[model samples]
Target: MSTSRAPPVFLLVLLPFFASTAFISSVNGAAHMTPETSAICPTCPYFLPTPREVTTPEGIPANLTCGVRLLADRKVSWIRRKDLHVLTTGDFTYTTANKFRALHLPGSPYWSLQVEKPTVDDSGIYECQVSTQPKIFRRFTLNVVVPSAAITGTREMFMKAGSDINITCIVKGAIRGAPVTWYHVLPRPPYTEEEVEEINAGGRGGVQVVTDKHAGTSWLLVTHATWRDAGNYTCAPVHATPATVSVHVLDEEVPAGLHHDLHPSEGRSSITSPPCSTLLTVLLLVLQRVAAVNEHGHWCSFCLLLGITSCLSLTAVYTAAGETWTAAQDLSSTWSVWRL
Candidate 1:
């Protein structure tokens, strides 16, 4: 009889346990074989595309960002292209400048170089470099600006009454299409507060404002300017410093640098006419002396001729005073009498 040997009792007892454990192992291995459960292999460091152009105003902080992928065990550095100076390396700054700092978080792919209080000199190309077998870098352009506002002409302007008032303001290094507003501050009494108003186009007053965004210029025009328009005019830009110009309106022509104060209580302005009044007084005293010398009636024609010539000369001087002299009409009447 060819009978097979019987298995051991211990082997038979452990066989089922071994079979269950092998079955469990196979199932777990198959689960891990799936795409979602597989391990990811390390990749070469590379830069991810982000905005490479940055613009910030002076005295403001600027951030230059660099997005990286699979940067395991490699270092990232920031270098200024202008001077070839290394600024930061892997969350640490290499330069001694306090303005430069490296910003990065643990396990984060984004690395940034922070510039505190950036100035115009800091505006240039910067490079974000990665350490690999062959070094790779991405270039970023930084533009720092200083915004300012200024008027094109003199700080103080004089305009005659009934004339047009023209004021131009220019804004530099400001954001494009930034609106510029015009403001007028009326002259006030010595102890009183000033009154301010906004100027607009087609307003109730004859004031008009024209702005050219592309040219970065704003113009204020007031047709038939009057004393009421005399005050401080300000050009305020949304992104720049405000600029001011003083406007002085006169009823007649006046020399530059000459100013007049308005008296609201009197309802009119006053000006001193010393040149014309003093000349007239002196001429009268001289004519009286001439008349006394010719009282005997001798050389009467000569005295009359001398007086007439003197009056004519005085009239010429009075006319040269322009419209500033309020007594011009009175002086003309006196000259007519002397001629008669």
Candidate 2:
């Protein structure tokens, strides 16, 4: 006999132990929202619309922007959490540094920090705070990357009092903000980097304040370089680490170097020559050989002259003799070369 029985509730207590369990959810349990749930798009867990990523400024007068979704009300007070620096409180804006200015856009929820051509000392952190449900505060790590003083273009010199030589100091990119100061070392380099650097790069060497593409690039076009322009040149690619380049001008530094003399390892990418000398020499030799052959073949010239004279004489005789022969033909029988 089989007995059907429902298990006791106490006995079913073991059921939980036998069943599989899910993982423990973290504090942020709201997972990503799929597009299928279009209505919840705005309130999606991962729907934080962060501001665009901005690179470190290489110069002064930088713009830092913060995004706010109609939430950062007048109660907006900026408090930097990283360093615990209270930036703004109530309607009062406080900044010890005179260069910082906060600008609130009209009709837009974007506030920006306009840093007045800041310097290496002005680099720091900035926080954008908005009084919202979660008190939305964006922390932006601000850094002013002073560009490395790398070579931009060089000033190479070769002059015959009025010959041109190009020395290009090729640097990476124009660094906005700081002005590039060009300095030159007189006499020669002192076998040291510190010796090459000048106290005021902008003072000497015909101050070329690069107003154009200052951060990444700049060029000095020197026409007809002379003996006075040869020295160790400097390119302050970054104001902090002003780079230096040396240009030596030679009176004989022109484009009049031999093609074959170019070192194979020179890495110069060019191949060109007029080939006038070689072509002229070959033509002269051919003309001379032709003239020599003509001199050696005097008999050929004489033969050609004789043939022409003989042809003329034969033609003359044919015209004159033909008439007489025609008449004589009646008297006698005759055949001539011209008639044949």
Candidate 3:
């Protein structure tokens, strides 16, 4: 009777064991036999595979791609680092907030956010996030470079002493209202180079700065060129690279020492010789001496000999003067022309 009363008490213990065995068997079967079964699939964490850093020019469209592997139904997003503003989510872009759109090719596991008319303000860190049990994220840095400041003139400029010099600096793709400054830069003297002092926008001594704010342009003007003005001039913008130009001031005549050193093939001679008038004056003097000799044709032999010697000396001087005149003209022609 006792055995009958406790009959099948073991059945209750065996029932749970059988059930667990069946469940584990099903799991093993699905894992090994039914490879395409989703219920038994092992989970793999989502990941982003794109460049961590990107650069683009201003005023152009920029696209930041976020590619994922095994991300199955997880959401993708882009956020601004500065403000934490969400830019895109799962192929949807917050267009009203930013000129951006999320793009996903059909049946593809990758997506991208495109920004239109990117500016300096748009440069910074951005985050791409995946919505999961434990959220996964990636950070991307975007750098925007504005076009460098450019001085609208020849790199090498020449100006005569007492002449006015004007140079313009133009900037493109810079932030609005960014100030541009003109600086005078001089290379350090001789062997041990030193840092040269920079003279700022208001003009140093005889230099003057005129800025057109709306046009993004600045002018560096020298009222009267002098030896002091011959150096390096730079147009530097607050947001861009500096543009440099060289200034060379020429005197009315080339110095004798410089003239002797210059080769005929050299680009420019440091010294400038006098203009055409000197040659003309020499010719006139020679003609006057000949006229005196002709007016007194019956003069004494001694007087004649002195006159002949004077004429020969004048002719020699004239020949030497001609050579100097030609060299001066060649040097003058090679001087870089300064423009307004």
Candidate 4:
């Protein structure tokens, strides 16, 4: 009995395999029953609920971040809500655009989508999705701003001498009242080095800047403008593109199609030629001189010389007054009078 009958050969052969199977089953059951083991087991992937919001200026890089907890072996992806296009997944970019890329560090729970040189068109909502049985997601907002600075009026300005130069600079998409700096670039010789001077408010006589912080506008005023003030004026604002305007200061006459306000001090002096009546009077005087020459033949040479001299003087006056056609007409009439 103690020795028992010799165990069957098949039972002896299968005993080790049965013991191993029972041992494995018991270990697995114990693992499930242990609280510490259950607590340490991997959990389902879920979003950490840390919402991200980003705003970046145009041409700058924008980062949209997403935080996830317990994201074990799950793929994270970024999708643009505007077009529903998949942007990035697990550090790999799906779009053909090179500006977009996914950023993730080793052993980090945060995933970020970076957009280089972002523009205003890139602003919109983005979704960060995690691969799970039901699929979890977190939404984020990205706003791209395009800051700009420009002068209010035309690029080229014609200002008269002794008139005031008033220029306005407006800033858009700025976070707050942007500080503006004015620069003056004087006209220089072709081969000479350019000279740029920084303009300060209240630093010189009749030159000052008025800023409206609330309106994000700055006004540059140069009282009693002269020929020396004619050049290029630039308005540079912080975090915005600079704008320039060319200024031309005329001596007395304003060109045609120019604004009357250019010469505020001298009220609208746009005339370039004398009146028709004055020209007619000059013509009659020349004719009268010719008649005198014809009447007195004794003083022929002296009277003819006087008539020629009077006609030539009138022609010179017409030419100097910017009336070239009138000058030519007067010369023709005088020749006719002399021939008569």
Alpha-carbon TM-score of each model against the true structure:
0.51, 0.42, 0.37, 0.49
Better of 3 and 4 by TM-score: 4
RMSD of 3: 20.2
The lDDT, on a scale of 0 to 1, for candidate 2 is 0.47
Model 3, 170-213: lDDT tens digits are 97756657788776654333443434455554446666777777
Best-fitting candidate, scored by TM-score: 1
lDDT of 4 by residue, 1-340 (tens): 3776898999889765543332123222111113332243335444444546887778877788887766779899999989999999998999999999999998998999999998889999998887754465777888888777889989999987899999999988664666888999875544557688998864568999888867879899999987667779998877778899999888755443332334444442453554433444455566567767676654655654665566567667756655554556655665565465
Candidate 1: global Cα-lDDT? 0.74
lDDT of each: 0.74, 0.47, 0.63, 0.72
**lDDT score at residue 184, model 3, on the 0-100 scale:** 69
True-structure lDDT of candidate 3: 0.63
Higher-ranked by TM-score: 1 or 4: 1
lDDT minimum window of 10 residues, candidate 2: 20-29
Runs with alpha carbons beyond 4 Å of true place in candidate 4: 1-45, 49-51, 150-170, 174-181, 187-195, 200-232, 244-340
Measured with C-alpha atoms, the lDDT of residue 244 in candidate 1 is 97
Question: How far does residue 324 in candidate 1 sit from its true spot (Å)?
Answer: 15
> Better model by TM-score, 1 or 3?
1
* Per-residue accuracy of model 1 over 257-333 as CA lDDT, tens digit each: 32335423232224233454445545555665676676754565465456546655665664464424445554675
lDDT of 2 by residue, 191-235 (tens): 434334442434434433343554355555444655445556766
lDDT, candidate 3, residue 216? 78
**Candidate 4, after superposition: displacement of residue 233 in Å?**
3.6
